[model samples]
Target: MTQNQINQSAWAEKWPAPAKLNLMLRITGQRSDGYHLLQTVFQFIELCDWITFHPVDDGRVSLQKPIPGVPEADDLIIRAAKLLKAETGCEQGVRIEVEKNLPMGGGLGGGSSDAATTLVVLNALWGLQLSMEKLMELGLTLGADVPVFVYGYSSWAEGVGEKLERIDIPEQWFVVIKPNCHVDTKEVFLSKDLTRNSKSIRIADFIAGQHQNDCLGVVRERYQSVKDALVDLSEFSEARLTGTGACVFAQFDSEEAAVSAYRSLQKKWQVYLVKGVNESPLFSKLKSGNIS
Candidate 1:
């Protein structure tokens, strides 16, 4: 599509970056490089941060507005766009505008998803024609969680959360509560008390009702609000942590049940009623817009 055609397309104005949940997270081992070997299941949620990429003639990647408290240089969204340009040597530039709805530090994979969206959409918008495998490879350099979002599927992940095999998980309604505290992932992983020796389990085990998060004990011990939110949410359903979470979530078989729990929880907490999806919303839009 030409630049004028891109600007004329309805979907070009906004792209989605969806939040993800770790249906289960297990630290099976620690790598020599200090990165933990993870066995986790990742599923996308309906909640998303919308991003708009405005074409720029000047070959300069920039954000429309800097995210407060995050330096533009350090923002993952900026870094991802620059990475694409550096790898492809594409002269095309974009001004990124974000509608930041997902909360930071919630273990919801918000930043990683935003970065993945930048990589995927810009690769198309700039006519780079990089394959999905190449995009996933570039995404891994940004963060462990970014590749799955780039892959745009529900996955069974291992090896520091990058090795992915697409999985068909039942889409369920969820009630998520974001606690009034930030759970620093680095701090949680660095703690001497955090679990690092969980035995690896098969996808069969995950499907058969084993959704243990190794970080729960450590995070609960440190963040009282997270612990409290878990307790309150568990009152309605089996609440589980989504990856060293400041947000705890409970899945329901029906949307009605999820909405009921969300209503009760919202009175005292920052809550979201969301639906699990096998496909990332970013790719869904790409398909809808007939963008390959």
Candidate 2:
């Protein structure tokens, strides 16, 4: 169903908003405008926040219920829906129902992914034939990370994460630990100690195991809980902080290894065992739904 053809039956289908991890991030340079240039590898995880749209007779966008501590209008998904409506002048409205499974402030790209999903799915459900490029352009206004999700692929991202080249890496098992704290992304970026300029290396370097996150040091120093989580996760494998994170993860060659680590950590921590993917789950769902 497209546009006016869409009915309440179309609204019954649920859509996925998958989370992403920055496999590696480097601060290549800082722009004169203070926008930090980046060299980052993005990979999606199985974790997702599911969303369902309900038809609203009135031409007003809304959420089923506002997330506590966040106003409905301030929610990224809400903002994304409104953005799409404004861009197309679509008179239709929706009450978005979110099943938020991804932890907030985990540096897992949950919000950006949610926003991207909203943009992509609504464009389809509303029968707005915006080009994927146009949608990605709109997504960038939401966040640097949003474009990657809208692109629906794992990629090597640069230029504050908007520039992307699709790159597929190993889809390994991951044991992720969400530290009992939120690392403020703005604080990490604004810190004087944060690395603003670092030599950028080729994807070959990352493939050959040059996985250094420039913000790791600053984040570790500022959040003791994050530091502790990294230290604990490291015991099982090579631990990495995804973006500026409160969630530290370790990749394992086998699900058994990841399961063992997850089991041990779950006794004392909030953690998840998930698999990595080169493509966003959203794309897979779209394909299966025959809606892409």
Candidate 3:
């Protein structure tokens, strides 16, 4: 049977598109081509959007709400599928089902994770047989953080977020709060006051000392909701913005502590207690053919 034939025989199950937290981001420099050079640690959290793909005859992709306020053509999931099919010469098309749980533009890397999940699962379903590196290369066209999800491991990221080194992060629970406001990453980067000249530090250095997201200042200024969320969550722990804005997170030593914090804020905010994972279980299940 051909690739499409195989996919048509079974109903594709939902795959995980896990959200990520940039524990710390430092802008080292800007590339001549306009990409930012940065260093950061990316941690995979239990918070995710689930996606399932079904084989389709026509070359098309689709989405389900709550939409991220972007056009369908600009949706990263479709862009990712089209890119993979073009690169690998796979004629198969897929109808995507996205159950979006993560907030849009919350700096949680939600959309990028969705795109990367498409690339990884479709590579297998379409029988592309591409290595993770090759898939990651394809993912880069979708976005910077896409590669890390394709890498399927908690990683240290740098250099426009493409360069990745797998790292063992401590297992912990996180209280993530989305203030329901969107902060555009481009605006934050272009702002004059945004820090773009922090000294580059080694991963070990970050592990040992204070590290911060350089985009925090610009994002906070533009979004008062995020600022409020940060201040509110700070009572539990030192609240920090993950990527650019709109979501703030605090780490807890135990699941109970995280859940307790989440429960307290449940009445007012969208709060979640998510555990950090080194490996994505969705990918593992797919690799082992558990979902086929």
Candidate 4:
């Protein structure tokens, strides 16, 4: 079964928010608005976080479990819900349960995806009747990456990651390894040694295999765990950092090949073999009202 299928329940208490990889990232420049100008490809992976929403009568949002360092009230999911409700003037609240599968601060876009999933699911459950564009706008207010999850596709992204162009990425299996550490993204970006001046490159350039994550070098130098994982995964194939990460991945032609590597690394570190997907499974179930 797919990760989404594995994450859902017949008992009615779950939804799926898949993880993402930055196939290629180039920091073209830093915008005056404090956002970095970027060229990157966002690819959806099968590794995901599952969420369940329980509607509450009072206009208050809560989380089932606290995120590591964040309070329930400060959790992005709650913030997303509050923002949506206030914008729509809706008198609804929810208890959001997040089953965390994606590792924290791994540069895998986990929390942002979770927040987006909450927004989308709660919008539907509350009958908010907002267009996807409107939802994306609301999502951007939360975070740049949030809008891409709301759009629900693997894509080419730019401009602090808000601009998106839906693109088809090659279907492959990946052996992703997390070196049991959280690499702070903000630290990577704030480093004076980061390559913020990478030349601009087009989507066609990536299609031709001419782009790479500009943040990789800074991340590797600052985090030994990320460097170690990259080296380990690269022993099997060419491994690449996904965003500014403590996680690194190498693509395989088949699931067996990917899982074979995952098994070997499991004893030594955290590893997963997951398929890459172009479409979000949530779209399928919700679009058809297949909740039953």
- What candidate 4 gets wrong by more than 4 Å, as runs, is 1-13
What's the TM-score of every candidate structure?
0.97, 0.97, 0.92, 0.92
Clashing residue pairs in candidate 1 (N, C-alpha, C atoms within 3 angstroms): none
Worst 10 residues of 1 by lDDT: 3-12
Error of 2 at 60 (Å): 1.3
Q: Give lDDT per model, in order.
A: 0.92, 0.91, 0.83, 0.82
**Per-residue alpha-carbon lDDT of candidate 1 for residues 1-292, written as tens digits (9 for 90 to 100):** 7654754463356889999999999998998999999999999999999998888889998999998888998999999999998998888878899999999999999999999999998888777889999999999999999999999999999999989999999999999999989998999999999889999899999999898999999999999999899899999999899998998999999989999999988999999999999999988888775455
Write the residue-wise lDDT of candidate 3 on 1-292 in tens digits.
Answer: 6546555543457778988898998998888887789999998888888888887787655654435567888888888888887886778777888888888878888889999888888877777888988988888878888899889888888899999998998979999998988888888888889887899988788778557989888888788888888888988888998988678999999888888889988888988889988887566656664433
Using lDDT as the measure, the top candidate is 1
What tens digits encode model 2's per-residue C-alpha lDDT throughout 23-67? 999998999988899999999999999999887889889998889
For residues 223-277, write the lDDT of model 4, one tens digit per residue: 8888888888887778999888878889898888888888888888888888888
Worst 10 residues of 4 by lDDT: 2-11
Higher-ranked by lDDT: 2 or 4: 2
**lDDT ranking, best first:** 1, 2, 3, 4
**RMSD of each candidate relative to the true structure:** 1.5, 1.6, 2.5, 4.2
| Model 4 steric clash pairs | none
